[model samples]
Target: MTERVVVDPITRIEGHLRIEAQMNGKQIDAAYSSGTMVRGIELIMQGRDPRDAWAYAQRICGVCTLVHGIASVRAVEDALDYEIPPNAQLIRNLMIAAQYVHDHVMHFYHLHALDWVDVVSALQADPKATAELAQSLSNWPKASAGYFADTQKRLKTFVEAGQLGIFAKAYWGHPAYKLPPEANLMAVSHYLEALEWQRDVVKLHAVFGGKNPHPMFLVGGTPNPIDLDSDSAVNASRLALVQTIIDKMRTFVDQVYVPDTLAVAGFYKDWFYRGEGLGNFLVFGDFPSAEAGTNLRDPGSWWIPPGAIVDRNLNEVQEVDMRADAEIQEFVAHSWYDYEDGNDKGLHPWKGETKFDYQGRGGPDTPYKQLNVDDGYSWLKSPRWKGKPMEVGPLARVLVLYAKGDEATRALVDDTLGKLGADKRALFSTLGRTAARTLETKLIADKMQSWMDSLMANIKAGNTRTFNETLWEPSSWPSEAKGVGFMEAPRGGLAHYIVIKDEKIDNYQAVVPSTWNAGPRDPQNQAGAYEAALADNHELHDPKQPVEILRTIHSFDPCIACAVHLTDEDGEEMLQVKVR
Candidate 1:
């Protein structure tokens, strides 16, 4: 017998997602992932100047603050065939690397940690034992018995006030929560600590880009100028502060974030056995060598190489060509969008269209239940690489690195598996996904010092140029051009494609990371990453509170992560969230 289940507002913050899973008795038979909210950012870029695309595109998400801006600027630069100064490239590398470290750490502790760490279970823990467990994992300074006691006390107060998620009514006592009381207490404490650590880490963005959450960017370079004597520009003291922030990031990721992930994984060893959706992975590469005349297309020169691993075949890594229209395409068959051509065939971003077609998607006679395995259910288009669904993000990047015989990455993977007491085949599951994010964070954090030293050395050598003025004029006369700006965002590979005509944006398409992982099924009936992962190895302990579902979904660290709208079957508003 098969049953259907609906989970709306799958994320807790800025997104509107709905998941419907078909259950065969106790296990999920099939699952459908949907985005209820429309993304009109691409259409918004229709008539803007190509140089200004980054500013408008950066607002596409409430999180991943600076990724869109980076992609936007890169798109314009690629179209112009402009070469930025080495200093400018160095600045961008530092900023992008900092984003990886800051975002991964924040996601691990604030957003993803709660899925594994039981807050209510912590109150039952003895503070001293929690401290002992914490000390055994890492040498972080805050792991004192008294420190845990204070955190426990604060938590108890919140519980007594009936304010701590209504005292664990938020799946606190669920049977699937396997962490011991002491471990749970330790996790909860770091969750609180991470909140503070993130504040200092993002200051690096402010120094270079002028602010966090949509940091400034330019078509050929970053916004900040290198003026050693000026107080307002990226001066000596500011650069020193950047190093401090990088150190702070390395310390926390090493002591708190990495240890916490491994510790949590030890308890959920079974999760490492499943959730390998699509068996394919993709990475678009970022952080190119900050040297003059470096070939951007060469994977060997990139810090994060661009490549595709299809069918988990580690030996044969397929090359990714972003400029090839046939290689990467987005399908709208099951999405709430239209195309000049039929929806069955996918359109590459260069020729992508975003006309919202809600004719049969909603309004009266709309069966809310029909979203279960139906067409035009989601607002996200299914993006495919060479006509197949692929998973992207830290796991994909790590797997690509390991497969390409990167020794540092191989060691990290082996050490992680050794600590967990499991083999490497475990790298293709839910637990492995989470661990990959942590490992990637450590790798990026360690690499930040190199970028910082390069920037410092360049400044000392009197190469303080942070922008190229050669291609600043629109009349330099390439009346028409098109290009792709791609990056390895914390979530996965993100790219912004732009078509320029008469120096204005003729068409713009942003194939974001979330769209790649959280999109709906294609006409070929290939399930997206979320659907395939959920349908693989999950059983419900309680249909009412689907903690199991959250465990797997949260593992992806979704960007459409949200504030939900609960309406009646008749389309009547039941719950409204307003900002007043």
Candidate 2:
């Protein structure tokens, strides 16, 4: 009999999430992904100065908060038609690159590694054999006897540190952890190393901005500029240091990260074949330029198995409209907000009317009204994709980039696939999604270093210009304007749409990464990114310890911290608020 199996609060990932799997026997028949927690971020932005939006948006996610800040600024700048100097552009690129690497390393080692590589399993690993394995991989950090010994010492130190933090909450001894002891030891060492690396890299953001978590990003340009002679600019010595870090990163990607991913995939080949979510992809190109009327950072568009499906071929790709997509609308039907369900509804924050009344059932009375409300769920709003659920983040970006291949990207793709014993076809599956993210990280990192070097050269050649001659007053603003600023964040495409009036933000809306991944069902009852992925995952061995769930979700690098709230009566219904 097909019955519902819910994996609420899926662990070891960002944000609060629940996956309801329709099960027949031991396997899953279909699944629904839901995240309804957190409240009032967008609504809080109303009536505030447009510049303040960056400050508030940064609070979206502690992990990748800077992306939100950057996106916010970009939207306002787009609306205002202002441009910054080349140096500022380069500075922004470097800041973003640091965050990308930091997020990637942390997610790999701290967030996702424990599932495949066990810590306790290390006790059984033969140190000698592990050393050999490392040698065979060539140039791996853990290959040396000292590194292995240091790993043991550090493990003890972390244990003594007595703060596993999220790891403490992890199911370490669970049966799903299948790595050998030696492998576990190596992975554990990498995990600790990654944390340190991430901490150091985050400082890059702090150096330019005030803090790390949510660095202040400017709209027209950087509020500050590097004085080449003022000790802040890169001298011959500092440039060397930055270059050195890039070199080391390249080495790690080539010798350690790439090799390790491939090596681990050998053991978990099952992931390559299964958990293939709706195989459609979308990418709004990233990286903006100082020049106007030029799409310098053009989107190399591509789609694999592209098309929309109603219900039968539910795994096909579909684009849910952010502005008017019925599946994309917010409903106060069961939310805490008291409003007429028909006309005076949960207006988008740009036109929001906030009147909180938290009295409702917190759950839907029937299956047909699943998003109305439910009990025990938090206050976050629900975002729907194509009236159905979909998956977002890296997997989506990779698929999108691969399909829209330029000569440069195609070369990288071919080389990466051959090394992993994968072909173009295999990339249309779960493994491809994971591998694409790793590869893209390296690609973007290399490009960012180049951009930084170019900027330094520009400054050395006597160009101190960082801002254009543009007015900042109300007269500088347009009477009525609409524009969207899109960028590929560490997660996925993040877009912000703004409508301004007399230098004030009249209506501001944003599409965050989680809204793409974890949205609920829409009016036409379309599944979102996560829901589409879950529905395709048929082999769910343990609902309580769903390793498959973790793999699929992490492949998207789902970050629900960016999601905001909706008032719900039933408590089950969650709406995704894209408030400024």
Candidate 3:
């Protein structure tokens, strides 16, 4: 066996992930991805009330707070065949769109930018030149030389204090970094600006859902009661605040997020050739029309159409049927669980099981330095659509929308590709994944305005109803029912499958985006998206630094916490890193 390079607890993102690569000299020949923590959320929901499932499920991950909540409510609604009000549909669209814009910008600036922008390099940058560079990109008002100088001073203070703070533990001076000092400085400034910008944008969630980070959700519709005349409810003042936030979101996305992506991408154009994984994509589709009882399966009315694209063939998009047992199934062949049919067989979420069977190199008494990759390597089960692993998230959703011939999506994608002097094939690589996120942010942000306008117009026309009380009580549902609630979450296709028996959750399973992308090898010995992308033409410049590995993995914006977290037997703090 060849010596493998291991990157345990890959940092700078949500959740814990371990990557082990089998190296052939300087090139990566193979790789294994492992989700070290076990997720028993499905099992935890057993025997719980179906209506209260969203609250517990929303606790899945603090980073992806509202997605699970939304999915949970939709699952219950789907099971009962309950339809929400038109105003409620538009409100949900606006909230989901806000989440897209907010989450994408946060990921790009705070989580993923440090992979490309060297904070240490910014120290050597000329403030005047950085100002000029920033001005050339966008008409953002903070492009003055003095603004750049102030940012540099703050950075210098952090560096001189013998601590990089949030910039600590980064591979700053690595040879893989391609950005110039000036570009790095400009990016750093925007990074700080984004921190403040997000604080204001998240207020939109508070206005509607009552709070941010696991916003309140009702089964039939949104929690907020609509009453334009009532100040306590979603009144005129609250509606105006949402509009203001949407405008700010549009401005920041156009000026900071989109431009920064293009500028940084210009330096790493070579990335356009690597990190293409599986070549198959899946999106559940979200953002329904502002019509009462709008069908979610109809792609024509969806803002971001849902479908599965195989082998990067944009010409033919396969419709994704969430209820088909064979279409979307999870295999525990390489996961730390056992299925009743044995490890070789795949089980749909409606029939999913979470039986713990940890078979590592060592038992619970002792820890193994490396995982038993040949047996079960991860807690995340390999999810496949019709027996093929599919990449999800921004890349999948963007491609599906573009392939479906959405005029706005087509123009945005074509214009961006033309500016980069790249073709559609580039959309399959690491740079493509990153660029797709920015493009989706723009599309969602622009659509937010229309949603807001529609909402206000409805209010003026005396349609202020937000909730549908027809099936609000569990007594109105059938004794036994099963359904899947899915959406195009910021990370990718997020779905929650629920089986209700006697108004209680009989069984529950959540197939999140990260699981689709970062799962272990399946029963067929097929590598997941992360493993395949890492093995495809990835050369290690410095085995110790491993910035290249981080670049490709971080491009997916891996959120392992979506699946589980790490903790010791005694519940002591195992890993700790300070963040300002």
lDDT of 3 by residue, 117-147 (tens): 9998999999999999999999999999899
Q: Which candidate tops lDDT?
A: 3
Pairs that collide, model 1: 13-562, 15-561, 15-562
Query: Which of candidates 1 and 3 reaches a greater TM-score?
Result: 3
| lDDT of candidate 2 over 398-467, digit per residue (tens) | 5554544445567877887787777666665666677777777777767766767777788689876555
- Write down the TM-score for model 1: 0.95
For candidate 1, give the lDDT of residue 235.
90
Candidate 1 per-residue lDDT, tens place, 337-407, comes to 78877999899999999886653444455455547355577778999999999999999999999998988
lDDT of each: 0.84, 0.61, 0.88
lDDT-better candidate, 2 vs 3 = 3
- Displacement of residue 359 (Cα, Å) in model 1 is 4.5
Ranking by TM-score: 3, 1, 2
**Per-prediction RMSD in angstroms?**
3.2, 5.3, 3.4
Ranked by TM-score, the better of candidates 1 and 2 is 1
